[model samples]
Target: MNGQVMKKLLKIAVVAAFSFQSAIVSAKLEMIDRVVALVDSDVVLASELVRRTNSVLQQIKSRNQTAPPLDKLQAQILDRLILESLQMQMAKRVGVRVSDTELDSAITRIAEQNNLSIEQFRKSIEEEGTSWAIFREDIRAEIMVSRARGGSVSRRIKISDKEVDNLLVQIDNEGLSRVQYSLGHILLPLPEGASPEEITKIRDKADKLIRELRNGANFQEYAITYSAGQNALNGGNLGWRNASQLPTLFSGSVKNMKVGDISEPLRSGSGLHILHLIDSKGGFETHSVIQTHVRHILISPNAITDEKAAFDKLKLIRQRIVDGEKFEDLAIEFSDDKGSGSLGGDLKWSDPGTFVPEFTKAMEALAVNEMSEPVKTEFGWHLIEVLGRRNQDQTEEKKRERAYRILHNRKFEEEAQIWLQELKEQAYIKIIDEN
Candidate 1:
């Protein structure tokens, strides 16, 4: 009888231990893998969403703010992942890729921006508990996505000379200086697949909130309490935005409103929005522009001349120019910028923002008659010489350039919206876990 009781106890203990081990193993496997979302043929894994969410959570903590509920945050992150997956798929189909060399160069540029060397950047990421390899891959993916978006959007943007002229006239009518708005926003979200009654309720709620705001309620406090936007916790502040940069829905409304004015409830597909103007500045700022007259010998790398070779060649050319070689002769003989090379590399007088940021910055740093060290721009490696500087009255050329830029920006925003919506509507996106 004693032996039998002891055997029964031993059997029970073994069974319990095995069951516990199995559960531990099951949890570990589940934690590491699962499909969170599906974008057409591709899926966003649970692990990927969690990793990205953790990064955002860290940012929130560093800002000393309370994070939203994990499920809510995860759902939002999952949506982003779905979009990224779609874009990446498109990128793959279009044969868009960021090469290893490009990735390395981009990483190095980022490191330089952060005042660190590439190795130091790796150490910094490791110190922050992120893998360097993973970081590099993340950057490469970002570049791919950016390139993909550009490819999709650029083809759709069309600005004619007539459109540019019309934009310039509109700007001149509005006065050269325009008001930049700092806005406080409140969004009453319209749920996905919301019924007409539900939409009416949200819009009515927005109207009530707007009335309350007009009746002397604090806008920031109201935004925090009532807004369903991403910035609700931060009081729905849109920060300062030029009219051109404002959301298409808000821009027209904001343009007419004065500082400290509250807008009527504006309806959009996503939700009802109420905006309070916080402040206004600039657009009233005069264009006391300092113009620079500069010229450069540009050399773009081809299959025959790689980036390193182009850079080295420019460096030698710069040395020759410094050692009493005539810049115009060298530019005519060797520069690849056919238009400027034939003109002895003379770009002529240009106001600020006329050129790309890299070219502008390097040119600005050089004194009149001083030659820049081989500087790299989107076009290519450049050896710039600032011929002169002056304070000039705004010219038609400058006005036209500005108008083209403004029109391009406005049209780009409008087109981007239409394009992105079309992409999303056509894509097959399925959420594995809705909650």
Candidate 2:
């Protein structure tokens, strides 16, 4: 494989390792004896499952106002473990591999996402009782599986003009509900106590980048390599995002652009920005009030030892709301969820199946402006309030277009899975069980 592909694969493997850490275990007689489950070429250990279980539980406790029963959690863990084994087998059959560079880049991306330096991110993981080596291996495996899937399935999928036309017709008939847009952005960041020369340099850089893009130097590549933003790794994808999802400064520019157009660089408080329109659909003249928001919360379990302690803390907060205190105020004061709690735990309007089951259940249970009791999920205790709900009557055209896209994805996955299974059946796999 090419170096780039190898790098990507390695990074993916690290992610996989982190994802499946709970399924592998090492022996520690002083602590607990490690047990092996199904051992393929990739070993599944009891310690790995335990680690994963704890990580999942921690996540659940963070967002949920309540916890799921242990039996349910165990089943979920086993399902994940089985899926991992299948993917790993597929990777071996396909001869998918990851390189060290890819692993480093993936780690870098993770660090950036957490707003941490690479060293700091590593330290954090290490502190959580995980070995970085194991993490990297997991990520590498994931990368291999992804490459295998893409190589096997993407080559066969074609986007035809007829398909596009049909999709458009359906969208037109249905009255497009979710607007998709193509956007390009140039950011101009201000320096502290910047002189004229510094500001000029910043603008000059943006201008140069714009010139290159206009001249047909791939914008996505430039964004990936040069953009000093979180979305850089995604090649500035921004992905079918809503206008309201953008910053106020860029949203207006995005709203005005047609497909395949570029915007003039505009200055914002943080920096200067230039946007290019890739494509857009739906939201022709109006938008539905409801938007689906998906969120994940991380809770530190150092404070609360048992489920009761966690539940009790959340329950107390709920009691305060029953006593007539504002939900937002309670969220700000007591909720351990930092991301949404600051906003009074408002997830904004979202579509169905957008949130974790527990969070969705709470939201669905509440009427408009109605507050829910402390509900527990894996995240932790949650008190949800439904802000509002709206059901837009979609046209037949929209339905067909949506159906086609969904079907295409489903088919791709199905084909990819079959291909991987065949590859696995042909490959040489050896299992070394140490436990």
Candidate 3:
């Protein structure tokens, strides 16, 4: 690991421990809790590899599947850990930390999704031999990694309004709605400008993988172990993609596949490829419009004001509103939004996508009359309250949104692969353990 990267990770660790002072617990270090791999400046501990490998083994066992060799599984898990470590480091540098409140909310949502209460969720994890703190930290790490990837990849992606319009036109040409495929992909990447002999070798490897997949080996497991795709660490998930949004090379094979069918080895410019159609749905999925009656007090940081100052100011403002002070009056007095400040911060009824992504996400998460904690956006910091919500007919708007999503997902997949490959190539990674 590089010294600079090590310092950065240590700094983040200290800050995180300080931030969660009360919750921080000291665990007695085991003898084997030493470095297994160096990822730039970060170290992947032997203990971490064992813990993650055990978790993966449990998952496979629960599925009634034969376990892969422990050494092989650990190698793949170690690579994933390295990628995660890199992302966490990047997230800290990019100011993409997930807050405790946000993490708690996410946990609550997870419990609800599983039809369990918070207590039940806790009990379940404990029954499975994992502590609540460990589960929470795992969840937090996942969110940080997701945010880091988005922050890093989003900047590289460009989706023009014209492109959206063009997609809408194409959607119209095909039909309003089409089949969406849930795809898992594996790419046996060839070296750049590879000789014909090297290409043949890679193709033969792809052929071997196909036979294994056909013989009941898990696609995701093998993808993680051997594939060199951008989403290899995510088990090569391309996610649920509309037919038009799929890579042109994949479209032909995918369109012919039934649910649960896996594609034969297909050669593309980048590599030899295999795809599994996990499921399919939505030839004509209906759409509806949900509008929020929202309002917010903005606090833009200026030359004298920093992000922390803006956040602190909004926190106090939010507290005052929670203490029964009039939100509109507070907005009128302190909001930096000139137009909305005069209007008592009343954004009124607005359809989704009208506001920035951060603002939209915060607003969507709020209950009617519930004010959010200080949230940051490109404009600055904000304290948002959802006044009301209503569902209305918005066929055209929904169509446009669907079109934009398809295009965005397609672009994101392409860019994410390139970005991840670049990160791997540029990073100073060394695997200490031999497989």
Which pairs of residues collide in model 3? 2-40
lDDT of each residue in 57-93, candidate 1, tens digit only: 7766776656666766666667667777778878878
Candidate 3: lDDT over CA atoms? 0.81
Q: Output the number of the TM-score-best candidate.
A: 3
What shift in Å separates residue 158 of candidate 2 from its native position after superposition? Answer: 5.7
What's the ranking of the predictions by TM-score, best on top?
3, 1, 2
lDDT of 2 at 238: 62
Instruction: Give the per-residue lDDT digits (tens) of candidate 2, residues 1-435.
Output: 545335544655665565566456542213232334443444455567778767656654554423345655554455346556667666677777788998899879989999999889889888877788887887887788677667667777665657656645644554433565667554445544568898888888888888877787766555544554334334456667555345545655776777776677777544556677887766653323344333222222345456677666767766777788787776666667887778866666576777789878777766676767666777766666666677654455455555456445634643444454444455444432554
Better of 1 and 3 by lDDT: 3
What TM-score against the true fold does each predicted structure earn? 0.61, 0.38, 0.67
- lDDT per model, in order? 0.78, 0.61, 0.81
Models sorted by lDDT, best on top? 3, 1, 2
Cα lDDT, model 1, residue 335: 97
Instruction: Compose the digit string of candidate 3's lDDT tens values, residues 135-234.
Output: 9999998999888898777787777889878877877786536778899999876555789999889888888888888888898878767877767656
